[model samples]
Target: MGISTKEGLDIDLYQNKGRFLYKYAGSFLENAVKICFKSRFPESGSKRIENSSGVRPRMFEIDCLVGNDAIEIKWRDATTDGDHIIKEHTRLKSIASSGYKPIRIMFYYPNRSQAKKIQLALSDLYAGLGGEYYSGEAAWTYTEMRTGIDLLSILNRIANERGVS
Candidate 1:
């Protein structure tokens, strides 16, 4: 055999591509979620196209024509592991044989730990350069979506076990 190098199966890609551009990544994932809803929604008539409003009800309307239910998009870099990403996806999956699909779109971010969390709290970040939602409801349950990896889920699970005690 010849001398082997670690270049082929190396996992150091993280070091260089650490922080990702959420604006770019969000656009890509937005397209992916759009296609998913379009295909899964119930086909009462020919499918139509539309854009995003960053709300659940907006997604539910399309689900009526198709079958999708919701769309959750996330942009991350390095903190959220690939495995954790997949696990978090099951939040909307069916557990019962007769259960309906509650999920429309569940986008994920691969590595956004040390960066800003994934919640829709602050109206705008980076001194408002990234922008924020100026209209509509000021506070929704969406605030809980702020956790990075499993922090949110784990906290929820524990609190649930306590049963408001």
Candidate 2:
């Protein structure tokens, strides 16, 4: 008998094609946030830096930076890995240390009955992570949304009052 690389599997186990949806989902969310803020207030100064190829690696390049606020938009699939947790830890630390407010907006793909429960879960996770990573005042808010459209009014208000704080 000859050696078989495929073994008993009918499909290739290792492939990079599956990640495109995640990438697209992230871009879609970023654009949706940007559009929402811009449409509501024309001079909100909201910009999309998600796909920006900066001169150097950004230590904490959030999705949208308006005024003194750093907004991070996440498109989650009901699962968070270690790397994601660590990255958020560092990102929030960087934002706070840089004297900017850190605002996290998470969009969960899976629908659940109690949105409050999901929000509380995320808030608890961030609370622990923020406590360990950030030393300064944690004056940030963790918002969980079932859909990107839910962020329109909230983001608009944040962007509009960016300079106030």
Candidate 3:
């Protein structure tokens, strides 16, 4: 990191902070959703299952497991990487092989065309596997319906409290 000027150093620091903030925000949202699910389904929590697809990772983690539903929660996924679909496919298969129905809940949908295409593919993949995928408004509705929690309203309140529009 060879930054000669103060402006350059500030820019680099800002970018680094942005990246960290993105990760923290995603984790925060995911955990919040999991907590809501736990409140509704006291026995449900994260689960780790062995990858039956013989993939690189030997294990796949379900964000929240309620009954036969293996849930994967995401605040947002904007990955343009094609390999992401492959990995997700493997993970969903592993979850299904564990005698559970795979369900994806993504709170935010990416605006990029490539990312949107990826999400569409995932939705189709889930449907093909007899699973379910929910994103954006549908994800919010599903969470509220399943957990009896108004997550969007709660988030809006928190944002208002934090002086974030």
Candidate 4:
């Protein structure tokens, strides 16, 4: 094959595989966190609330809602798009207006400066709206404290058993 054609093929393959890996990993981690929360708070699970603001979607999803708390769980969020801030702001506002305290818990923190900035903005937004944001080690600690489950330790044990590291 020609050089350009080979390069294009390689890029396409990489993009497809990357998308699958990211989606699968994120879904798995988010579901695991929800499971932990459900074990502790039997009533907690995914929830959908009206956007009250008449947003385009007209609805926003809370990954897990326990009592009055609206939680958004993520394995990692590395989006550098400025639009993300606007969307998240709207979502949080809708949650708040619906009488729920918005919360965000992300296991991994983005390393890129732009992505870091986005996360910082989100953290501030959460605080400004009377919500909470936790990422990295703090996220792990928060999950364990709230669920009475040492998630990291359990994951480590599983990894060791599978000889992953």
Candidate 5:
């Protein structure tokens, strides 16, 4: 499993405004995913969250932890940002392989089309990643969203594709 924590998690962004921005976006998405996860799998534990008092990783700290799950979230804003997704995916896989119950490597691009470009480009980054043909009535809600979606399903889909889950 990932590092056992006495509390939930601790994020330590380096910039001054970065901290505020991180919390704003992070809180939004966390709520969104928590609802989705509970609706689909009520038995699954809901996310338990915590933050660091100050910035600190020291090369040995988690960014965010949800229950027994550990996650590291990042954003990419550039003409070409494929590498960012690859790096995050690899890191999460490594953590999972090491025995973490659920390792989430979430990457999303925001207000920049609210995630349209990111969703369109998701296949480009995850070449072998499979899809579930999201044809639900509320498909459009997640089409260009950065804060809503089921992380477990996404990870399970990808993990099953790579023979991980």
Candidate 6:
């Protein structure tokens, strides 16, 4: 089962001039994954962990927790920077080492070919953590809470609705 929301998700909520849009994009990805969780694990007691609004340097929050699993959804595009990538890798490694089942969902545009190259470049960052890299086509399975939900389609729908080309 896949999540279906009635209202349109607005990417414009995070649109700003000359900004990386990390927070906004993170929020959007969290919400999207939460929707998938709700539908897929309706009885698993899974939910998106909420945090207080406002910018704080040390704020800690996991994207979603399902049956003792810590899942994070990342929307990686061509504009993604090295610093943010390293930060996320460190977080995932820490979470896994702490005994949580760390699952990372990496969303990329265009196709798996390009996404694979990007994934390979990040291997060193996640090295020694048994991190497995999958192409975009196979990424959904690793990050999915349940089968049959097309996450890429949901992303495309959001992009289309937001007129993001």
TM-score of each: 0.25, 0.47, 0.89, 0.89, 0.32, 0.51
Clash totals, every prediction: 12, 0, 0, 0, 0, 0
In angstroms, how far off is 52's CA in candidate 5? 29
Q: How well does candidate 2 score on lDDT at residue 79?
A: 46
Show where candidate 5 strays beyond 4 Å.
1-21, 45-83, 89-121, 132-165
lDDT winner between 1 and 6, please give it: 6
lDDT of 6 by residue, 1-165 (tens): 343343222333334521545567656765776777767777544343322322332344566666666655556544345665555555655655555565555665434575455556555444445554443566666545353577767778988999998
Q: Rank the candidates by lDDT, best first.
A: 3, 4, 6, 2, 5, 1
True-structure lDDT of candidate 1? 0.31
Which whole-number lDDT from 0 to 100 does residue 139 have in model 5?
Answer: 29
Q: Can you tell me which runs of candidate 1 are displaced by over 4 Å?
A: 1-20, 42-68, 75-107, 110-165
Lowest lDDT sum, 10 consecutive residues, model 5, at 51-60
Candidate 4 lDDT, tens digit per residue, 61-154?
9999999989999999999998888888889889999999999999999879999999999999999989999999999999999999999999
Model 6 ranges with Cα > 4 A deviation: 1-30, 43-59, 77-82, 109-118, 124-127, 132-135, 143-147, 152-165
Q: Could you tell me which 10 consecutive residues in candidate 6 have the lowest summed lDDT? A: 48-57
Measured by lDDT, the strongest candidate is 3
| Model 3 / residue 156 / CA error / Å | 0.6
RMSD score of candidate 5 (Å): 17.0
Q: Say which prediction, candidate 4 or candidate 6, comes out ahead on lDDT.
A: 4
lDDT of 2 by residue, 88-160 (tens): 4555556666655666555554355354444454456556534221111121122222122445456558768
The candidate, 1 or 3, that scores higher on TM-score is 3
Q: How well does candidate 4 score on lDDT at residue 84?
A: 86
TM-score winner between 3 and 6, please give it.
3
Evaluate model 3: give its lDDT: 0.92
Deviation in Å, model 6, residue 70 alpha carbon: 1.9
Q: Which residue pairs in model 3 clash with each other?
A: none
For residue 5, what is the lDDT in candidate 4? 81
- Candidate lDDT scores, in order, read 0.31, 0.49, 0.92, 0.91, 0.42, 0.56
> Which 10-residue window in model 3 sums to the lowest lDDT?
18-27
lDDT of 1 at 90: 29
